[model samples]
Target: MSQELGITVKKDQNPSEWYTQVVQKAEMADYAPVKGCMIIKPYGMKIWESIKEDFNTKIENTGAENAYFPLFIPESYLEKEEDIVEGFDPEVAWVTHGGDKELEERLAVRPTSESIIAPYMADEVRSHRDLPLRLNQWANVVRWEATDTRPFLRTREFLWQEGHTAHATEEGADEETMLRLEQYQEVIEDHLAIPSILGYKPEHDKFPGAKYTTTIETLMPDGKSIQSGTSHQLGQHFAEAFEIEFEDEDSETQTAWTTSWGLSTRTIGALIMAHGDDDGLRLPPRVAPTQVVVVPIYQEDNRDEVVEYAEEVTEELEEKGLRVDLDDRDHRTPGYKFNEWELKGVPLRVEIGPNEVEDNAVTPVRRDNGEKKMGQDREEFVEEAEEVLENIQESLYNELEEYLQENIREAESKNEILATIGKNRGYVKTRWCGKESCEEEIKDEVSAEIVVLPFEEDSKPATIQEKEDHIDGECAVCGEKAERWAYFAKNY
Candidate 1:
């Protein structure tokens, strides 16, 4: 492969450059004309489609129906929720004119749908029958962030599904919050093959106006942490602010509890950074756009025979319900095709050379680790490919799982926390006093903050701090009596 065509930088040496090279060289995405935005090319969009489809099914199963909301929201709507508006005010993009004329009331592009969705829920929800007003919208939002711009990671405009649900009781809202969070865990860990830490964001970092926020945080190969997904228990904040009152079982009007959860295009960035290598991307089979690619190796003399055999193998894999592509382009050489497919992170590649054609078999290559199985019977190869794909997926996730387990250092003091994070570039688990001032001071010093306070086994986030039976230690920063265990990390 040419230096310009293949990844130019080694992943371990320079992850940032390697990522940019893979995303662009492999034709996944390209930088848009505008700053802080990217054009998600076909390859990148396909991966996002996989994430959308998986999460959509899970959301719909929970009785949340898909709906569309306006892209431009009235400024007054956001003002209703002071915290939500304040949190996003710095990044909000405002529109003051309509084509040529100045508008009386300037509108704000939706950074998040809470302000708009909350009002709609307030109007639609009138009775107990509408207790669980579940609605989700797959849409694009704009946030005018001007720092660390990267494709899919910190984009100005990105696609995501924001779920807005209102429940009659706080318990119901809590259940809904945790339910969506667990589903996000499944999407990230099971389908994307990226292991993650599931927990509640510290009080200081919880989503604006949320009672608490649950998140799945994953570590990148470069040591920075990516917030893979988030679920927020909105409590009665939005509902009360928006006047989302409903008649209950006793016919009394009460404020409804609301929850909002979102998993965005950022997951695509996490997937690329998590599993990709120096060769290029190494997509997990389940979410890879093309699970298998058949490359026919042949000379001018045996071209017809080898190409036909590659098609036969492709058809066999397709018949077995695999997403297979037969690269029969006449101009590109077999070696070129292999590099292209490998760069695109096709999970499995079948090389149907002259020798394999004569043996009535194909050599299946695993993209994850470059393991090859030679001379397997054609019919048996399809069955074997299924097992191979599963193994590849499992291996990708296990590698990250082991990394996560090994790198989470337990710190007993402030210096230990700083040293651990500085040296290892991963999470430092420590006892925090649950004080915002202490957290602020620590952030000023180490540039790392409490990312999440993990729930104890069979414990809820609301009650975990109160239980106090599991851990007993002083605050790592202030030496105050510690409340619970939390993981701190430098983040993306």
Candidate 2:
């Protein structure tokens, strides 16, 4: 645990540098030869596996089946829906040749599986019985990005689960959209221990071809906003484009309503930014690859006894359903092991020394607060470890909750909104006559745009008279009456 091998920069001072150091030094991930791509190391991959298992279980319980789709899409298929193609065209990576032979129709590496999946759905779905087709795929996608490639944040290729569903009616599609978003919120907030804001993206910010997009936005420590997850209501756009029609009970053919939602490796970036500290990554207990690490402190006199006791404790903790690891390599010093585990950000550390062994108690240290508490009976220690992990999760969430509240400000005027965004580095809650022009104007003027238009539009506070008045006020940029209040921010 030398300074050179650990994070040297403070997060508050140089967050970008600090993050880079942590990711590499902690052996989480490594930069690949290709720019904008990273190799997920064993530790990093383990965390992702844990997250995937949890989400897979949740979706499976809700009747979603996992499936695989082609990784390449024909250019013509993508162009089936004009809006989707236009939105993704600039970012797509196309394969013009196959093994050196020129190809007639260029295939695009899947930026998303929508176009490829849609046409297949059209072929497979023929009647109302196949209406609610819920298919999810865990796959890799390529999006050719131009700038700022942070390991998990912005990358050329990344792993994610994209869930695509087709329903018989608009109401059913809407319900599916919200239900998936709710599940995402639960997995992120409760399991990942990250607090998030649920809202709808503005028309301009919605997914390329979606009728409307719902998202969960979480605030990072640096005050930037990270979109944790998103669910889109596809209306009849893709259904019509792909000719996915169903014969209803009434005997008429109608386009099926569709929805697609995704959660990506970027969520890992959010977790790092949200809860990590100078010590290193602070993973939530439920998702931590190693929830607890037992360091056996030994001396020549009691080395054997201390190591044996540590193994027993590790076995007991494992039996109690904890991911426990006993560090008995006999090579590293106790002090060194502590630093390594802290840098790796294990939620709890148990130090077993001769004194603790004699006293029948162990020393417990919490990663979040670095608080040391004397253990009790072995059974009690296991129970308290469980409680401590939960406490850490809650405390980490509350810390971010306070940050979100403090960073968000209610702005009354365009100038106020700009100033708030510039100074606070967070979102500005303001009244926007729901006009696309107003959103454009704000973007042009201050480079900040509407991120989310809350679903609970009518529940805005009464004190915001300007917002209420502008409910139909002329567009902030043009002269059209506003349609809704929006959360505006400069996004990553």
Candidate 3:
């Protein structure tokens, strides 16, 4: 492959440039006309669609239905919830004029749909019979962040699915929040093949106005963390603000407990960083848009025979329920097709040359590690292709899981925390005092903040700190009594 067609920079040596080259060269996404924005191409959207389909199934199974909400939110609605509005103040984009006339009330683009969705839930929920109001929407939101823009990772406008639900009790809200968070873990780790640290954010750093926020943070190869997904237990905050009062069986009116969770297109960015190499992207087969691409190698003389045999192989894989692509483009050489498919990160490639066409067999190559299986009987190869795809998916995930496990190191002192994460650039598990001042000390010194306060095994976020069994050791930063188990890291 030429310099322009293939990745020109090594992934570790120049991660930023390597990412840009792969994103555009492999047809994932392109920079939009506006800075801080990107147009996700068909290839990139394919990955998001896979994420959506998987999560949608899990959500719908729990009685949540998909719904649509407006993009423009009235300023009055946002003001109803002071914490949420204040939380997004700097990034909120407002509209003062409508077409030609000046509007009486300003319109704020939806940084998130909590303000709008809460009111809608208020209208639909009236009594205990209408409890557990669950709704979600797949849409785009705008936040006018002026700096540090990148495609998918931190775009000004991006696509996501936000889930909003109302319940009669805090217990119901807790169950709902943990439920969605687990589903997000499945979507990220089980399907996307990216492992992450699961925990709740520190109180000072939880989502604004939320009772608590559960999150999944994944480490990138470049030593930055990705806030991949979040689930928030809203606990009567939005319900009180939006007047979502439902009547109980005893005829008492009460505010509903609410919860919200979201997973965004940024997962596409995570996929690129977690698995790509100097050659190009290396997709896990579970969510790869095209699992297998069969390239027919032939000359002008034997084109028909070779191409026909390749089609048979493609049909066999398709019959076995694989997303197979037959590269029968007459103009492009077999080598060119191989490079292009490899750049696109197709997990498995079958090179059907003249020799294999004559042998009534196929030669298979693994994209993850470039391993080859030569001269396997055609029927046997087709029968075993599904197993190969499964193994590739598992192998890719295990590689990342091991990397994440190896990098999570424990630290006891403030200097140790700074030196370890500053040089190593992964997670530092330490005891925190739960004070913003102590957190700021580290943030000011080396830019690593408390990313998570994890819950112990078989523990609940709401009651984890209240448990008496866990000990409160000295804080790593101030040497005061520690209050939480925290993971500190630099993030994107």
The 10-residue segment of model 3 with minimum total lDDT is 462-471
Predicted candidate 1 versus true structure: per-residue lDDT over 1-492, tens digit per residue: 667778878999988888899889989899989999999999999999999999999999989999999999999888999998889999999999999999998899999999999989999999989879999999999999988999988999999999999998888988898899899999999999998888888777889999888898999887788998899999899998999999988999899999999999999999999999988899999999999999888899999999988888888888889999999888988888888888999999998899999989888889999988898788888877888899999999999999888888898888888888878978888898889887777689878888888787685655333544467878888998888788888888
Model 1 RMSD vs true structure: 1.4
Give per-residue CA lDDT, model 3, range 346-418, as digits (tens).
Answer: 9999989889988998999999999998988899999989999999999988998898888888999999999
- Best model per lDDT: 3
Misplaced by over 4 Å in model 3 are 458-469
Task: Give one digit per residue, the lDDT tens place, for model 2 in 38-119.
Answer: 9999999998898899899999999799999998899998999999789999999999998999999999999998898988
**lDDT value, residue 162 of candidate 2:** 99
- Comparing 1 with 2 on lDDT, the higher-scoring candidate is 1
Candidate 2 residue 449 C-alpha distance from true site, Å: 2.2
Q: Order candidates by TM-score, high to low.
A: 3, 1, 2
Give all TM-scores, in the order shown: 0.98, 0.94, 0.98
Question: Deviation in angstroms for 364 in model 2?
Answer: 0.2
Clashing pairs in 1: none
